[model samples]
Target: MASSGTPSLLQRVSGSMVVFLGLLSVLTSVRCDEQVPVIMWTSEGISLPRQPPPTAGHIVGHQQLASYLEKALNIGPRNVVLFLQDKMSIEDFTMYGGAFGNKQDGVFPNLEEALQSSSSSLVLPAVSWPASNAVIGQLQDQLETSPLYMDPETLSQLRLNASSPALLVFRLPYGTGSDLLSAKEILSGNDEVIGQVMSIMKSQSVPYTAIYTGLQPSRKEAASLSVEAGLGGGRSLLQARGTHRDRWRDRERQQRVKEKPGVYPPVEFKEDDRTCMLLWAKGLTVSILRNNRWEEHDLTPSTFGEGVSPKLHGSNCDKSKGRLVLNYENVLGHRSFKLIFVMSERHYKVSARRWFTLDAVELEYDGTKARFNGSRNIYAPAEYSYRCKSVTSFRWPLLIPRSSKDPANQWRVSFDDFQIQGFNLKGSEFSYASDCAGFFSPGIWMGLLTSLLMVLVLTYGLHMIMQLLTMDRFDDPKGPGISVPQTE
Candidate 1:
């Protein structure tokens, strides 16, 4: 269909295409920085009633120790660099830079490689004073301010541009460091740092743990500080600044944490597989029971949450004579576990108000189970259904059991859902951070359920009416007409 006047396209390949190819050959390339292996120790001064921590406690000391050694012994400075102290070079003293270089002097690569060979940087600087207006003025004149410190308030913001696989170093300064390092007199102004530190640590990662150390004037001086001050062993001995020896010990513990399979709790699960439970004041017995049996279980949830599930597990005991007790440790909410019990030989009349005991592991009452779902629900999965309920503890509806003449019937009383939560740090998998679909507001869910129920009822009623109408319209003239039956 081409017109005769059209030119042959093959002969007219655009000269513009040729020009474009030439520009493609001239494109430039840029290189990205190579990442390096490192350990960054973030430091902060912990706030107790007294002053600050010594070396952010021992754990971080260990991490610093490991990073220190890795930089020294790794046989390559290009491999690992502790970014905190610019002067640090496989040392055990001073700041991380070469300050403690003697610790790794002979062990690590040459001094130059350790310094210049770093293709990447890892920071592990201990925190001193909050880089507040006061402290910033002091540091700004000396060392270059770290990017995190660009914002003057960053130090006050305890949780800032933090690094990962990161060690948070909390300070427990003795009176000396404060007087020596701090710009303020009495350093009482720095107390805000402690309050900020605690507020942030609680909601951070499970791997996120704290190490607290202190440096103080003297033992009696610290003891005089008082219990409300948050001192340990109630003395000033623990509140003193760490010397060189303290650093070494901290390093030792840290090395074990790394080389050894499980030293302390990292973000990962460790040997203890420790599971912490938030128990309530009412569940002292339950806490005692759990503590006694701690080793037997991997991680027992010592706390109860808002709602109880339909299926429940665990054991409870009724210590009080007429009172029904439910074990909840630090757990706030009314919903507790259900008790499942079998019928005994006696045909006792069970009252909903009366207390009965159900013993799974411990003893608790059956009817005593609180409705956690009224305002909140305590969620329990299927695996924890064993202690869901026990009957001997609480007064529940009575079910007739076999008499002496009859065979024994193995009966089970179940509390379908008992509201409780435990530390399941297995990451996702129904652990601390569950991806399970969330429930709607109780009122909203109730409305939805009611609407669906009404729909079903209406459909059922309409079906019956339609059938009756059909029968009436097609009734057999010779036979009796179909009659409506009472709806049950």
Candidate 2:
């Protein structure tokens, strides 16, 4: 009985183990999810009151504030203005303002003194309201030109104020994650929020300055009064603006992709048209030898804008003369690269085919042009019966002459899955015969011989069977008087 129950007991033990492991994994995943939310600063804050203070003039968002600082403070090219919102906790202040006091004490007595002593060079400044419309208009104009430009609807929603804007400035080094390191220095401070904000700024490569407001609830009525005499705000307005700009750039890129030529139907060209020849490839790729390996660059309409053109002035449809030239301003960091295809008609039996002979491939680097002229041919059927959907591919190597300078290196170019259509065709669509070898392969010949041999073997086997005759023996013991009659 013990032996019979051993397998069942082991099965239950294994099942229980799996269940425990699954529960443990679930708990671990939940803990990871909970840790994902960290303290981060953003541009979001309460809107300014509509009622203007006696000393206030015009209300503006952080963007306008940054612009005003740029002009008023004469901010250098390397310097930027970053803003922080008012009414932040002590920990938040310590993180942005830089490390001050021991963790055990946890008290900020003189914020101004601490800010001055901080590594980030924090400044507390009370910016008086600009009463001049010209100044306000100029600031607004600068905001419009910025990559983080706000829409007109949001601009109209901005309220006017008579109170001066309170600002806390951090004059830190202008490199990636410069301010984040200041926050990180404090062992007990929460640097996650600032880390997230700095990541956004660093990715966009945008310079920024921060304005941290130290406003309190008791001073809400007196909006124009400065907080703490010199204490700065703690929020990041540029972080949110950078995110918005990233989305805008994404939309523009998607629009450009939609407008690319090959995404839509091919343009039609008249048959026997002499003015323009319709010759296009789905893509043009150039391969360059780098670090003992080849690196490929695919040229698109965006990269080589309107650079693919055919030389049709001297091209004659009747004479089978055509030339395609591709000029790219930049390829693989080279100054320029030019590829020319000299095309003509080749007659095979009763059919004529369009053929492109590679004339010259040149690469311009450091003001010197390296030209490679090779005898390579690409051909397709000339008749329109071959549909444009059919594509032909060609790949070849351009070996540098051994006698010439760089005999050790060889350059290769591959033209893959492209069509050369509209030579003397009715439409710009490419037409080509499918690449196929006629029924003369060695495999086909072998199959035919094998089938013939099997048929001959079967015929001989049947002939031999027909030649054999069976002997008949008659029993004459019982029936003595049996007479056999034979008929011819």
Candidate 3:
């Protein structure tokens, strides 16, 4: 309360103080926010000898790379924009990769041409820099003759923008000129392009990245056995050896049984019942081979601009009785190959039985739904593990039908992303359903709004009636009055 001139002065002073305190609180809050721990960003790059092989792993397969990135950058794949670079041959590039291969094709161009079209940074050729060196020399010479060249201004801006965490993939894609260093000699080379690549990155002023995917070691295994690797016609070496051994053992067993028939009743036995089946990921594309015709399932929509490849997921097959099954049709020229992978998804093919079913595909061990994308890549590797259904090593036993024309080519499926979720007492994946929250939660909000509208309508009607009655008594020219009430 204000008493007089003095009180008024106090009030004015207090009001100014309140405003100052509020501003100070806000500034302090902002200062505190800025003081929180920040991530120390670093940039690095990877240089591989050859173009990476195609990965049959599914969308979840990216998680393996993501894991490494997370460890290096403290950021996941979804949060970072990775720049993957490599060189490919003309034919292989266009046929396998969606990117255009030759400059003559006109539709696609080299890095220099691409820069021109996109209005991005220009790329210049640099001298060979050894991989061991931190930066390259003669950077100034590089800027003058590059097919696409970036000015000093553009380089500075890009460097600042790339200061955040990211990953870089470089390839000494050029053939060793005349040097014949095999894949085994991947890390060797004094004049390899990797050095130049690093130097160019520094001059451009982009943030640094770390080596992620590389030509370090192969995770795939090769299946090998002695009996003349053959086509549809080959010797059954394993079965033959087993049969011979059985015959020799039987002769001895029979003699004993004949001599001791009285001691023991003739023993009877039954054959063990077990089988194996093929199971791919659910919704995965399948190619059925019949009469030289192939029908594929789950075709990608053309509107997507690029098509995805068939994903290799965990198979949910009959695991109790026999070996797993697959055909060599997918192989271009090889009869047998190794499969190395991690068990992203694992199940009993059923809740209890070994016969795989759709139910297995729908649930994770913890009952979460998995989202699988259909795509392929070069650097990604299938995770390796010891689960019965995974491709863990190069040497695996695959049994094919004696007759290629056998009927019923049905493939069952279950899968894990190798990096995300799979394999448990009851398998399931963790799925994010944020969109559903808005659509579903809106119904409750709408209901509350409707209830509020109803209350407002009732209150307005009563207010309108009271206002009309008062107006009639006060403003009407001829209106009845309560004289008795006034006298009282």
Output the number of the TM-score-best candidate. 2
RMSD from true fold, candidate 3: 29.0
lDDT by residue (tens digit), candidate 3, 329-392: 2231222211212122233443543211111111111101111111111011111111122211
Residue 284, candidate 1: Cα error in Å is 17
Taking the tens digit of each residue's C-alpha lDDT, what string does model 2 give over 358-438?
333344332223445532433445553222222222233332322243211334544433444425454334455433234
Kindly list the per-residue Cα lDDT of model 1 for residues 253-319, writing each as its tens digit.
4566567552231111111212222121212212112334421111123323222211221211122
- C-alpha lDDT values of all predictions: 0.25, 0.34, 0.24
Pairwise TM-score winner, candidates 1 and 2: 2
* Best lDDT among the predictions, by candidate number: 2
Report lDDT (Cα) of residue 54, candidate 2. Answer: 14
Runs in model 1 with CA error above 4 Å?
1-109, 112-451, 458-488
Q: What is the lDDT of residue 83 in candidate 1?
A: 18
- What local lDDT does model 2 show for residue 271? 22
Worst 10 residues of 1 by lDDT: 27-36
For each of the candidates, the C-alpha root-mean-square deviation to the true structure, in angstroms, is 29.5, 30.0, 29.0
Q: Report the poorest 10 consecutive residues by lDDT, candidate 3.
A: 122-131
